[model samples]
Target chain A: MNWEFILGRSLSSAIGSDAAVFALAAIGLNLHFGYTGLLNFGQVAFMALGAYGLSVTVATLGLSLWWGIPIGLALSVTLALLLGLPTLRLRADYLAIVTIAASEIVRFVARSVSMRGVTGGSFGLSGFADEFYAVNPIPGGSYGFGVVQFSARALWVIAVAWGLVAIISLMVYVLMHSPWGRVLRSIREDEDAARSLGKNVYSYKMQSLVLGGLFGTIGGFMYAISQQSVQPDTYSTPVTFYCYAIIILGGTARVLGPVLGSMIFWGLLSFTDTALRQAVGAGYIPTAIMDGTQVGQSRFVLLGLGLMLLMIFRPQGILGDRREIALDAH
Target chain B: MPTDTWVDGVTPEPGVAKPDPILVVDGVTRRFGGLKAVDVEHVEFQRGAITALIGPNGAGKTTFFNLLTGFDRPDAGTWTFDGRRMAGMAAHKVARIGMVRTFQLTKALSRLTVMENMKLGATKQKGESFARALLPPLWRKQERGIEDRAADLLARFKLDNKRDDFAGTLSGGQRKLLEMARALMVQPDIVMLDEPMAGVNPALTQSLLGHVKDLRTQGMSVLFVEHDMDVVRDISDWVVVMAEGKIISEGTPDHIGQDRKVIDAYLGASHDAPTTPEEEQRQLAEAEAALDAETAEREQLQP
Candidate 1:
């Protein structure tokens, strides 16, 4: 059963470029759900916009990659404003409904036949990352520690991605500690209390939405650059659910929770997939039970089981304190 | 009590004018579909005095408070606070303009530290701004000052020992105290309290009343809604009574206690206030008619 292959795959996946992407994405989700009680169910839409905003600017509009970044960020901000305006003043569940619908709209529109010429339709887009890689400062070679390795190009992406994650994490930490964050927590506890105290609850909510969506936008950029592609299907409903799992797995409201959670989530997923594939190949398990491709899909089923167990056993997550989670004053 | 007796020798009536008014409401009306919730033609709150807004259930007292504080928008009226045209302003803006209010259901941020809740109440916080929040050096000194003020308030409210604990851990009475102390952190010119003594133990009600009076001593106007007659009488320099959607009377607590309308609204059956000789005679005539009918029936039975 190739223990070496299994451990190496799991270890690399834990800290790989995709892990960095999920980290940024989950960080954004943490801000929205954990701290502010904003139920942003369509985080994937923000990510998709980030990807498309950059890709469209580069591939369709023929702009530089640098210009694409700002455009993508602005698109996310506009999306946040759109979602927050109608629902934030009302009950929070309305946002959850609006966001899921928003993500679906983004996906369908991107894949539509009329937009194919611009968005590349179902095939998605490529050749946009050439400009991104052209600026890579890394020298061409293989880099590895004892257990995990990557090509120079991959390593460069990983470096930039993790660096962004770190900076964003630090920023979240600082912001959450500030009085501005205090106001947000207050709103989460009771919107009327914050309002009566003279806090502009609507404005603060908008700010949080815009700010967290910006992180997801960055996640989109990293996803595009790492995979060297932007596909509508890649930023689907499952991606957001994965983020929710990661946040709950690590801990909500804790700054490092998502970051650590991302690493562990990807690691466990890889570990389970590799183990199952090997078990099937070695004839240790019947093919009728599972084949190689089926093994790949079964990892998610395992994730569901794991999530259930976590909810039952340690719902506060790794870093969350049980006392902090009692949003229910009862 | 009003230092200058601004209420003395003044006309005791609905929509009465005060000598030095801090809040003035004119033609304020709020209707919920078919029901008129509040319809005050004019009402003025005296500056630096404790004013109690009293009413039974659904009296529109709370609705008027909500309109004045910008929590609920009035349909067709305007109000002025501290001489500023404040009608239809956002609740936060009203608070920024030195007027703040509390909810009937106490809204203490339960998950936050008691100290954190107090700091949130302070106004003009530099750290509250998004751009400035990231720079510790920019807001750190100001934050420290806010902390000092919060610490003082926590002690004053006897919440110092529970400063680091979650606000939810506090007892009901303590939550009410914390909410009031937090409201004071606004450094407000006036504080509107909705049911400050609600859900509070009787032992703490006295202290809460004292705090309301203390707001006046600090030169801040105190307008509170209360059902407890004793509390209203003990603390309020002036009393405003409301029934159904209109101000029925305004006077000292002593006068409000004796007003025929207030007594009827508070104690008498809302629909049956008539008690006169003419009404008695009508009732007697009906009884006499019933007796004559009964005598006719008895004659028939005897035959």
Candidate 2:
């Protein structure tokens, strides 16, 4: 077994592009679920829209890449308003139902054959990331410390993705510490009480929806640019659930939670996969018990068991105060 | 006893006009599908007095409070606060206009620090705006001011020691105090409390009553819904009695206690005022026997 290769591969995934994408996406989910106590099960829709927003604008409409930013933001905000205006004033469960259904709707429409001209059908649009790559200043070369080497192309994307994560994280930190974030947290605690105190509960909820959706939009942008494609299957229900897992694992309501959770989640998965494959190749585990193809399925089972144990023992997640997240949902 | 009389020379009556009225309700009514939950008509609150709204369970006292405060919309009618038309305004808008209220079940924002809960009550917070929130330098000084104000209010409520603690950790009575103190942070002209003493311990009842009295002394009107006749007689200068969603009697606390209509609504008409001392003793003994029988049955069930 090549131990050096396994360790290096694990390190690469721990802070790689996939981790960066989830970190950004989970931050948005954190704002919705953690800070605001909003159940937004359709976060993947915002991300999908972001990816398609940019790729379609450039690849299909033939517009400059810069136009996609505002277009993406507008699309996500519109979706948030559409979902929030009616449901936010009612029960919270309504929003959850609407969001999960809406996300599925977004995915289905993007992949349908009727809109193939615009969304490129199931195959999705590609070759729209040229402008995104053109802005990269790093020279093309595989550069890193020995075993943990990264190609300049991958490193550039990682740098931009993680850089965006850091900036957004700081913004969240400042806002959450302020009185505005207090109102959102107060709403999470009790909507009627916050309303009684004269905070416009509906408006705050709408704002939170839009702001969190915007984060998902940016995450989409990163996902699309990193992959250089916008496939419908890539933005599925599992995507949103993965973001949920990342936030819960990191700790809901903490500024750095999503980032920390995403890193550890991807890192542990990568470590397990690499170790299992190496062990299998070296005959550490016989084929009758487990094989190369089974490793992919087995790793997730391990992750699921880990998550279950964490919830039973520490439901508050890494950074959360048990008292805060342990609220009886009204 | 609130020696200063309210509306001198005005006859003791339901919906009697107050000399210095602060809240004027003309015909506010709310119906929960065939059942008239609140049908208050022409009730006026004294500008700077502590008034008690008393009734039996399901008498629409709480529903009436909800309508007046804009928590629930009225089917028809118009009311005003300090001469401002308030019938159609939103609850938060109503609060901004200085009429703050508390719930029967205390909502202390359990996850928030006690101090954070207090600060949330203050109006016109610059940092509360989304754009202004991003820049700390703009709101830091104002935040410190609110922190100090919250600290002072906490101290006044005897909650200063638990300023940084999560409100979830507070005892029931302490949560009630925190809720009341948080409402005061808004600097409301009228403080409406729905069953402020319902879940409170007997030990804390005196302190709660004192706080309600202090509201009047500080020039704020207090309209509280309470079931305790003793508390009503002790703290409220005036009383409004409700039964089946309608105002049945309105007068000084002493007068309300003697009103025949109010007595009938509370204890049923068979509980006559003309009963002799011997008959009253017999009735009291019968009630005690019924209670003893219930306890015995409950203990038997457990066994």
Candidate 3:
């Protein structure tokens, strides 16, 4: 077995550009589910809007990339408002239902044949990242050390993605410590108690929804730019589930939880895939037992089992204090 | 006493007015489908006094409190707080206008620290604003002031030691203390407490009593619901008795203790004041006829 190749690929994937994207999305989920106790099952929808918003603005409306950023952010906020307006005042489960449905609707719309001219339908969109790379401050050359190196284009994207992740993490840390964050936590624990204290509970919930969606939108931007394309299937339901697994793997409510979570999640996933693929290729295992194509599906099964064990032994997750979880309270 | 007043065994009128009123509730009625939970004609709470609202089970005491504080809407009513019409105002708005309430089952925000719970009670906090929350300088001074006030309240309630602890860790009595302390953070003109002493232990009862009285000494109007007659007699300056959604009587502690309607509502109608001999005899004949009618109906159903 090629231990060197396996270790290098796993290490690189652990801190790759996709890790930054998942970090951003999970950080936003932390705000919704952790601090606010909102069950947002469709965080992927917000990411989709961010990607499609930027892509559509540039490819269809012919706007500049800079203009696309704000437009994408605005679209996310609007989506949050639409989702929150009806569900924020009701039971928390309603949000989970509405968000999941909303995300699915976004995917179907992007894939619809009638919208092919604008959205590129199932094929998605490209050629929108030229301006993004044109402004790249990185010199044209390979960067980094031994087996984890990136080409100039990859290096530029990783730099911007990781930088955004840092800024967003710092912002979340600051906001969660403030009095406004106190309100969110209070609402999470007891909505009536917060209401009795003269807090506008519905308004605070809407604010949290919009704020988290904005963070998710930034992550979506990174995702689209990293690929230099926007596709319908890329922002599917599994993406949200993956982000959730990352959060649960790291911890919830803790500011650095999702950031560390994404790194470890991606690393473990790649490691398992490589190990299983090698075992099957070397004929160490019979084809009837497991095949090469089955290796991809097996990694998720491993993740599912890992999540189950985490929930059973430590529902609060690593880096998360037991008291930090308000799941039952909600 | 006024014609509408009930002083010891005299039947009281439905609506009663008080001198120097601060909160005037009129024609406030709430119904749960066919059941009328509250249907008061008129009632006035005296300014800066500790008023006890006492009633048996299902007397709508809590429902009345909910309407006054805007926690629940009245089906038909017009109430005025400080002479401002406030029947349909939101609960938080009512709190913002210097009126607030506590719950029967304490809502202590169990996940929050006692200090955090107290800070939430403060109104118009600058740090609570979405934009200002990000900038520490903009609200740092105000937050410090709020924390100082919270610390002071925690100390007064003897919860200073538990300030950093989560409210869920608190005992029943401590949760009551926290709820009371949190309500006082509003510095309200009127504090409506729903059964503040319901689950309190005897040890903390005296201290909770002192806090209620202290609200009055500080010139804040205090209204509380209670079932413990001793507590009502010991602390209340005035008492309002309710039965089946209507105010049956209102008077001082001494007069309310002897009021026949109050006694009947609490001890059942068998404790009602004696009627005239001829009136009693006529009621006895009517009862025997009803008994015979019930027997005839029972005999028919037996087959």
Which candidate should be chosen as best, given lDDT against the real structure?
A: 2
Task: Say which prediction, candidate 1 or candidate 3, comes out ahead on TM-score.
Answer: 1
Clashes of 3: 0
Give the distance in Å from residue B52's predicted Cα in candidate 3 to where it truly belongs. 1.5
Per TM-score, what order, best first?
2, 1, 3
Candidate 1 is graded, for docking, as medium
**Tens-digit per-residue lDDT, B161-202, candidate 1:** 999999998899999999999999999999999999989999
Pairs that clash in candidate 1: none
Cα error, candidate 1, residue B241 (Å) = 0.7
Could you say which candidate leads in TM-score? 2
In candidate 1, position A272 carries an lDDT of 90
> In model 2, what lDDT does residue B196 have?
99
lDDT of 3 by residue, B1-303 (tens): 121232333323445566668999889999999999999998888788888998899999999988888788889989999999998898888988889899999988887889999999999988888888888788889989999999999999999999998888888899999999999998899999999998898979989998988888899888999999888988887788999999998877788888888889887988634479887888888889999999999999996
Superposition error at B216 for model 3 (Å): 1.2
TM-score of each: 0.93, 0.96, 0.91
1 or 3, which is superior by lDDT?
1
lDDT of 1 by residue, A220-279 (tens): 999999988888899889999899999999999899999999998999999999989999
| Every model's DockQ | 0.63, 0.71, 0.50
lDDT of 2 by residue, A1-330 (tens): 888888888888988988998999999999999989899999999999999999999999999999998999899999999999889998899999999999999999999999999999999999898998898899988978867888888899999999999999999999999999999999998999998999999999999999999999999998999999999999999999999999999899999999999998998899889999989999999999999999999999888898999899999888877777554432
